[model samples]
Target: MQTIPAGNYLIVFNENGVREINNLIERNRYSSIFLICDENSHEHCVPAFLSEIETEIKIEIIEIEAGEELKNITTCVDIWSTLAEMGADRKSLIINVGGGVISDIGGFIAATFKRGIDFINVPTTLLAMVDASVGGKNGVDLGHLKNQI
Candidate 1:
């Protein structure tokens, strides 16, 4: 029931957050919805996430492999390509549903795609809630280097 305002978005709790998200969707009139999650979240979190969203617009699930090694430019490129192939445009909204890797990479893709589309970070872990989702630092690693893109 708690709501924390973050810029244009409100970081809310549980199923209650979905209501505010629906309000956002109504206000934005996004052409489509992109739910970006890793394998773990897709399996665990996405079912609950999808059930609460009340929208007529098509929702696409973009599931990525779960691992730090997968959080690189190559993966970003693949996802970007997927977004394009799936008809993602400037009016699309990307909802990142997972922890750090998903928040970081998915946010990065949303920020850069079509010169930045709107995105929401639904951090499902303490690390993501305190760090990645709030950090506003998005980019990918170059091998062992962090955030080097």
Candidate 2:
């Protein structure tokens, strides 16, 4: 496992980690829950995640094209547009549930929407789990440059 910088995050490790997700959501009691994922992740992981959250909480799943090329301002615009169309407001919580590209772009969209909202990262790929999401590092790539904030 990668080491997240000290005091920047709260680490929780469990064999049944997904179970913790629902409990975490309950504890925070966000107004709404939005799940961000790629097409592949939607097909592969989303069902299981949804199954874990048996609560009656409002949940919105947003799926984008799975690729590094899709990580950009345009994608953020699309996600924000979706959020608007879905009636997602500042109180909604964004849960990123894919690889690095999805997490990076989704986090950016959530961070900027309505001057920022709550977000959680559930990275499926090894690279994302090992590197990207763990460090509080986030942002989409700009042409040849990988930007993080």
Report the number of the highest-lDDT candidate. Answer: 1
Local distance difference test scores for all models: 0.90, 0.81
lDDT assessment of candidate 1: 0.90
* Model 1 TM-score (2 dp): 0.92
Predicted candidate 2 versus true structure: per-residue lDDT over 13-122, tens digit per residue: 56677776777788877888889999999999999888887667878888888888788777888889999888888888899999889878877887789998888888
Give the runs in model 2 whose Cα sits over 4 Å from its true position: 1-8
Q: Candidate 1 lDDT, tens digit per residue, 45-111?
A: 9999899889999899999899899999999999999999999999999999999999999999999
TM-scores for every predicted model: 0.92, 0.89
**Residue 66: error of model 2 in Å?**
0.5
